[model samples]
Target: MSEHVDVLIVGAGLSGIGAACQLRAGHPGRSVAVLEARDVSGGTWDLFRYPGVRSDSDMFTFGYRWRPWPSETALADGPLILDYLRTVAEERGVDRLIRYRHRVVSAAWDSATARWSVVVDHDGVESTITCDLLWGCTGYYDYERGHRPEFPGEESFAGQVVHPQFWPEDLDHTGLDVVVIGSGATAVTLVPALAEKARHVTMLQRTPTYIIPQPDRDPLAVALRRLPERVRYPVVRWANVLKLVANYQLAQRFPAQARKLVRRLAEKSLPSDTSYDEHFQPPYDPWDQRLCVVPDGDLFRALREGGASVVTDSIETFTPGGIRTTSGRELAADLVITATGLELKLFGGIEITVDGEPLVASETMAYKGLMLSGVPNFVFTIGYTNASWTLKADLVGDYVVRLLDFMDARGLRTVVPVREDAVGERPFMDLQSGYIQRAVAWLPRQGDRAPWQLKQNYFVDVRTIRRGEIDDDVLAFT
Candidate 1:
């Protein structure tokens, strides 16, 4: 027999748990169930087990608004993040509503019944669950596989190759020479962490990425912790938000000045002998791609202490023991760690069909960065690329609950964003990163105007999503 529910939440991660908590608080009568593909609840936090895996953004904004993050540390590690997520789930009884290993394969919407028939794969068994509303909290990355670029002569490499996404537990790197391929957040993080255990660590990148050094513990948060969480949470959260906004604006408005400022800051953390322009300076301006944050200047410290090194070059081929660069330089390594990047996938690779017709994500336009145009009774959580993901995730959860409440008061069964005209379409994410650019063809498009265009700013999103009118003309109700 098919199970029935008022709402079926896909992916029991940070967003899913937040959504469930919001639903419980706002609409207590609604029957909600969360379907998790993985055995564990913490999605990204649980999936990535690599050394020095931590939040790129500060925990103050990264954490949910409703639940105050207890840690004084602005940046937290994977285990701590996982613990926080699990605590929220177990404490709120959201764990009871989740079905582990229940991977959603397809969702078919029936206009006649105004419900979604979701087909889920539970281990090897397949089952169906019908729901009035389907909320997709599955993040925009392929958890099954990280992006591994095919290097020439990779088959000839004798050493064990590893990806940060699927880090092996028993793969010992003690006193071994490690070469991490990528200059993004993961590469920067792993370099310092691995430098402690490995004999030497090298961060190999084709081009440089903007790196910023930040204090692991926020001084403001440290002082605020003396007070109660009720008094401290909002104060710290807003202060961090304001700081983020000011920094973002400075980067956007004055690119050259911002770039110089960031480079200067990074130079201070690096060795006095090392040239910042050669190793630390990126080709693009600030915020062109996401900046890598090094907590307490860990990466720079590793470099200064001669534990790690950075090489900016293109890989010609993977040699038997290491990599040969285009610049005729060969780097020897015992282990080649591909910190390359993630493969972006939407809705956990679930196929969506409405009235027996398949829906293409790229063809559809995103409505307010949450719902897709022409998609009914469905909402997906997508956070800001430039800011803390959970900040937008919390807002999305609140907005969704508000939308549901609006529907309940009006006796509406279906809600979908209807396109009024042929709006000019642009890429969903305005990032210049390799992973985002490569996946643009498969991702959704954004319109040239409001309601269809995504406001990447959290401050703007808060006002628009939380305080803006829900009964807009663009959204059709039935």
Candidate 2:
């Protein structure tokens, strides 16, 4: 027998739990169920077990708007974020809505009944659920595995090889010479953390990333601790929000100036002997890829203390002792960490078919960055890459609640975006990153015009998603 619900949320992560809470409060008449493939909540936070794993962005804006973050620390640790998520779930009764170990295999939309037949697999048994609306809050990355490229002669390496995504809890880096490959956020974060106990640490990269210094704690939050959470949280949150917005916009508007400014900041933070042009300079403009934030210049401090070093070169092959770069330089290592990148996947890699037809993601255009063209009663939650993720997520939650309320008032059972034939196609994600580039063919397309384009700006999203009218001619309702 198939269980029935008004909404079926696929994932009990940060976004999924938030969705459930909003639906329960906003539209209390509806029945909701959150399907979590893993046994735990707090998706990414619970999965990543590496040392010093923390928020890349400040926690104030990253935290949900409904529940103000209590931490004065701007960049919260992974365990703290997990606790926050689980706490929110428990307090809001969202934990009761989650069905753990329920991996949704496929969703089929029945046009006659206007309901989704969702097939899920759990512990070698398959079950089904019917819902009026199906939400894909599973995030864009493949949790089953991360992006791992085959390095030349990596098998010959005498040391242990580790990927930051699937980091083993038992694997210790104490008194070891570690070489971490890649110049992404993960690599930068791991460098200093590994340097704490490791004999030596080296961040090996083909190109340098834009590294900016951020404070570990928010001084404003600490100062205003005497006030209640409702009073002080918003004050600190907006301050950080404006700061991030200004940084991103400045970088985008004046690339050269921003580039020089960032390099100068890094130079001031790094050791005097560290060559800025050779090691700190990047070839591309800022914000092309996401910037890496180091709290209180921890990465730079490690470099100054001679605990960690940065190397800019290509990896030719892995030697018995370590790795050999294209420049014929060998990096001695006892443990090699491959902080390559993430693998992008849509809707938890679940198969979607509408009226017996397979839904090709690449062919569809996103509707206001929430729903897809020609897909009915379905929405996916994807956060901003430039700013804090939850900033955009909270806005999306508000828009969804409004949408459902609008539907209920009109007695509408189905809502789908009618794609404009005249619109030009672009990649869903505007970033020029390796992971996004690899998943181009698998992801959906965006448009060049309004309501179809995926705006990375948080303020623009607030105006459109938060306060904008929902009943535009672009969406078809039945």
Candidate 3:
């Protein structure tokens, strides 16, 4: 491979791969290289292997733009998603540009040279590469660590403890009493799958999360069958956006009303004996924390079917046989699956420096949720907070190509967000999700208006990013 390239993408995941495809399709002869941290591609899909793992969103829009999901169902399992990503990478010829097992350690921008010097560790040896543009598609997934809570006597407990993030391939669960801790998407997915195979599955959650039940068969299945790829894809995509927007608007304007409607929906799918207010009702407002969607209430069905059960209590400590609850109950478990949420890391834990000045994530302002203040010739893709991740990511990819195309036409080599002293009134993350709240200290903060604000709304993003002027006053060009 060449030592230098026009663009150096720092991930091989969905967004990164999508960016590569966009760049290739727009500018066919441009030299681009994708540096992946792991040995294989498929970022989230490759990392997660827990049972019942699938896209919470419909796969119709979740799959790549160039590729159509072959599954009859719109929501697919992990392996199928990985295969789709691999297919897209191969078909688009982006796989050849990826250098696996190369983790970017640090990137420094040189003002004089108008290039970025990126240091990466391949296998064990470290090397430096220079590029005109540094595009970070390293997604928000916690690659560095998993967020597992510390229980008293955790080390002393004799039971095997495993996290779903790093599930062992050869591990056996037959006849084992499995205790899953947490109530997020991961926990919900794991509990139902393990309950079927294990002796018993217990879900211990401290707080209840709003759960919405979806149909077993994907809603998009009919569309895929009746509509052509050209019509089906856009229809599904817009439908997803409309649904997401309606949900968001409901959550924002009338949270209580929305919650009641959602609770009623859940109750309709659940057993008659199920208590919606106690088991399903969330403390926070709807969309304050993300409402997890269950595929046909499988998790609820698993609980109702008797192999699985829910324990709405805090874990006091780890006992010899299982977990000891704060309510003075001891749950027996041969295996413990910590389905706790992921640990968030910024820029894939890589240090960013601007002209030898160390750049902290919190100090940098986001420009169109892509470029950072005081960072030049760099573009990163951060998707929607409430909807399908790919909706915004795909738009960002198209925007990046457009921006680059504009630069080419104008004979511009450098693009950077000009820093200012003004502060913003709005919070960086307006939502109250645990993942966002927990990582607020480590996350990037936004400012008042353009270049610093992050609009989670898809329509605003599409207009500002896709059709807006790339060479604006806020973004300095040379």
Model 3 agreement with the true structure over 41-109: per-residue lDDT tens digits:
999988898888988877766776556666656567899888888899999999999999999999999
lDDT of 2: 0.92
TM-score of each model, paired residue for residue: 0.99, 0.99, 0.96
Report RMSD for candidate 2: 0.9
lDDT of 1 by residue, 167-278 (tens): 9999899999999999999999999999999999999988899999999998898887789889998999999999888898789999999998998889888888777888
lDDT of 3 at 359: 86
Candidate 1: 10-residue stretch with minimal lDDT: 273-282
Reference-based lDDT, residue 247, model 3:
87
Task: For candidate 2, write residues 1-478 as lDDT tens digits.
Answer: 8999999999999999999999888988899999999988999999998888899999999999889997899998899999999999999999999999999999999989999999999987999999999999999999988999999998898999998889997998999999999988899889999999999999999998889888899989989999988899989998989988999999999999999989888889989888888887888899998999999999999999999999999999999999999999989999999999999989999999999999999999998889999999999999988999898888888998999989989999999999998999998998888999999887899999989998788888889998999898998999
Cα TM-score of candidate 2: 0.99
Q: Can you tell me which runs of candidate 1 are displaced by over 4 Å?
A: none
Q: For each candidate in the order shown, give its overall lDDT on alpha carbons.
A: 0.91, 0.92, 0.83
TM-score of decoy 1: 0.99
